[model samples]
Target: MQILNVFLVIFLIVAAIMVERTKDLLSAVIIFTSYSLMMALLWLLLRAPDVAMTEAAIGAGITTNLFVVVISRTRRTEK
Candidate 1:
């Protein structure tokens, strides 16, 4: 479990960096959503189901939808 936690942390960091470094807005938003889901999983692993669910609902669900909608309304690529 400890090793898994460490791996998850590493993955979260990488995903965050990817979100920042991507040249495409849509790709960045997708990576951010993935990062949020990973965070919810980490919360679950730490025995916080309520927080995990909240993160999943707010961060992964609504926020991702908003990002997608905004992306669809605007440009998909970043300058």
Candidate 2:
């Protein structure tokens, strides 16, 4: 249990950094979605089921959908 918590924290940190580091907008959105999901899981681990549900719904679900829609409307660049 302790190890799992530590791993989740580390994974969350990496996901956050990755979201910022990614140059592609789509990839960054994907990473942000993963980060939100991980946050939901962490909230569950911390005994905050209500917060977890909210994070999953709003952070991962609605927010991600909005970002995808916006990205689809914008022009993409590749290196």
Candidate 3:
């Protein structure tokens, strides 16, 4: 469990960095969604189910959807 926690944290960090480094806006949004999901999972592992659910719902679901919609209505590539 401890090892899994460490791995998830590492993955979360990498995902966050990827989100920032990605040249494509859509790709960055997708990575951000993934990072949010990972955060929810980490919360679950830490025994905070309520926070996990909130994170999953708001961070991964609603926010991601909003970002995708906004991105689709604007542009796909970055400068």
Ranking by lDDT: 1, 3, 2
Between candidates 1 and 2, the TM-score winner? 1
Off by over 4 Å in 3: none
Write down the TM-score for model 3: 0.96
Candidate 2 differs from the real structure by a C-alpha RMSD in angstroms, to one decimal, of 1.4
Q: What is the lDDT for 36 in model 3? A: 92
Q: Pick the candidate with the highest lDDT.
A: 1
Q: Evaluate residue 10 in candidate 3 and report its C-alpha lDDT on the 0 to 100 scale.
A: 95
Please, what are the lDDT tens digits per residue for candidate 2 over residues 1-79?
Answer: 9999999999999999998787898898889999999999999999999999999999999999998998899855445
Model 1 weakest 10-residue run by lDDT: 25-34
Error of 3 at 30 (Å): 1.0
Task: Give stretches of model 1 more than 4 Å off.
Answer: none
Cα-based TM-score, every candidate? 0.97, 0.94, 0.96
Instruction: Give every collision pair in model 2.
Output: none
Residue lDDT tens for model 1, 20-73:
899999889889998999999999999999999999999999999999999999
